[model samples]
Target: MGHFKLLDVFAGCGGMTRGFLDDGEFVSVGAVEVDRSAAATYAANFDPTGGHTFAGDIADYTNVPRADLVIGGPPCQGFSALGKRDPEDVRNQLWREFVRVVRESDARMFVFENVDRFAKTPEFELLRTAASNGGELADFRTQVFRLNAADFGTPQKRIRTIIIGSRIGPVVEPPVTHAKNPIGDVLRWVSLRDAFLAGPVVLEPGVRDEWFPESTADFQNFQVPGPFKLRDLHVTRRYDLTSEIRYAHIAPGKSRLQLPVELQYPCWRKNPAGASDVLGRLRWDQPAVTIRTEFFKPEKGRFLHPQWENGGEQVNRALTHAEAAVVQGFDERHVWHGTKAEIARQIGNAVPPPLARAVAGVVADRLQAG
Candidate 1:
């Protein structure tokens, strides 16, 4: 009975569920996700029987089971900083469904996650107003929190909006367990260099740090340890000679802005001052930037492998799937059930398990105390 049951609404491939499971204090009762491929992936890993899962729009789902905690968020495309931030985007209205399910589930508490920009949007205010105006969500007094994935253990700096609401009483917030260059017991922010859980690689701001176990050959040849092995996910990509030269121009810790005039994309050459992250390369000694849906493409974000200024074997490639999974907080043991693109999207959209585990711990403690 102490094992709190969980209902994961809008669950995206069980990222949040993974956290709760990792916390060892909760059990999944059900999960709902729109993308059938994603839902299949979630079910394969978390709901193999398919009896407690729904793979459709939240509006059409009515099998809300009673649980101690309900966690999820609507699609955040509208509020994502990577998008146009269109207030009129239909996805913005999905929060209404979240509120509806929360009301029906009769859960003691709920956690909502979204892009950081969601906190500032009009839709957020609408949800807040429902809580304040004695609407369906009124019984659940809500508070908003901001959390970063790196602070919770993931090797990427993915910041997100977290809103915790409870009908049982006020909910406690999350804890920050890591920091930049942490001193004593707290861990330093993990960087790409430490993605494999390698030894401490901290260095002065501009100093170029070499990979750990200097005897190891190179980034591409290295295998992800057994503990982090992923099934059915590969990050191998082919590149043309011209693209390779463009990547070479993107030195470690740098971007397409460093490319010479000819190497720059036509659009990039015209808009030199636009995005600095385009065609970017990652730094070995620092946490990665957010891994967006198209992380396989270096032109999309900082998805490139680090290279010495003098050049190396990995200079022309992007992060491998194992590398991206570890940095994004995923274990390879869970079998996947989607196309490569869908799987990539799931990884990009997931709430890092480490962060989710931290939040789940806080909630479980509060429920136990009560």
Candidate 2:
């Protein structure tokens, strides 16, 4: 069968786009992304020979190329749990652009994704109502699915809300292909160990970061992992001495709450019981928590590596740039550009490809039937 054409809006790093391409069920006719670094990363991976890869604002997309489907996850910072839920955030209004393109292009179906809380926002209600009607989608049926990436074999447990609109028929959620702690024939959730170790490039032994000359801080560098095109391995921002000492006190599966009195800071000491998982380590046996843009900082969340023995000494450092990408289900060979911080933002903002593929598999079936 001919491939169903699709367009991606706010296509940061092309995570959803990559998943569709990898699935072989759909072809991208066009994509729009506003951030320079993100758009650069997307262009580097996906060639524009297939279609237009617009690297600017979505609002400027006047003559949209037609496609059978339109898909995107608009910036969700407005409704994300990671930040304050500002009801009037400018980013929330981008969904209007999503709706406009879907209506203008007259696509048979559209898939909109965002943080779970986005479903509860007043802006979502407007987009939902708009997407349900307009052009060929009048009386369009929508299926809202709250999906956790870990349920579909991704190493990280990221819960996202997916809204699929179809003029053809009802869109059904994909069946879980993986489960937590498989019993008998049931599948088990992918563990952090599985993601980090299953890499195209392996970390070189005896290679370690040095301190910057001026500040006496750790300098970040990307290691070449074998012959893989993968860039940015083991790169990280400097952690202050105090944070490092605090991290040293915590073990894998432990957090700041476990730090000794000497290691605990004023805030942590004042409220020892609250704020669990701050400056925490990830458990090797379990799926990792959500990957956020600030995951490089242990203070932000449970991002530390599972302890590994090095010359009888246990090493417990936060996940590197590459490790975070792996956890997000990015291909091992995928290339990333820009500063470590910029890449982190791109990785954190992406939809895990495995999860997107699972959702696409179900959506493809519905569109194919029509």
- The per-residue C-alpha lDDT of model 2 at residue 228 equals 19
Cα-based lDDT at residue 316, candidate 1: 71
CA-lDDT, candidates in order: 0.75, 0.75
What residue pairs clash in candidate 2, if any at all?
none
Residue 259, model 2: Cα distance from true site in angstroms: 0.9
Q: What is the Cα-based lDDT of residue 114 in candidate 2?
A: 89
lDDT of 1 by residue, 1-370 (tens): 2389999988987888998888999988988888876777677677767778888888888878998898996777744343334656566557778888888888888998988888887777777877775677877788898999999878899999998887777756777788886867788887777764463322112222122111111112222212112532444567789998888777877888898898777887677799888888988888899988888788888888775567345557776555676778776555555556776787788889999999998888877876
Please write out the lDDT profile of model 2 over residues 1-370, one tens digit for every residue: 2388988888888889887777788877888987766766675677534247786789898879889889999877644343433646556557667878888888998999889887777766766666554633455778899999998888899999999998889877788878886666658898876766654445432225522112111112222112213433555556677776777777778888888888777887787787798888898788899999988788888988776443455555678777788888886647655556777798899999889998889888998899
Q: Model 2: residues >4 Å from true position, as ranges?
A: 48-51, 80-89, 132-137, 183-185, 198-231, 308-312
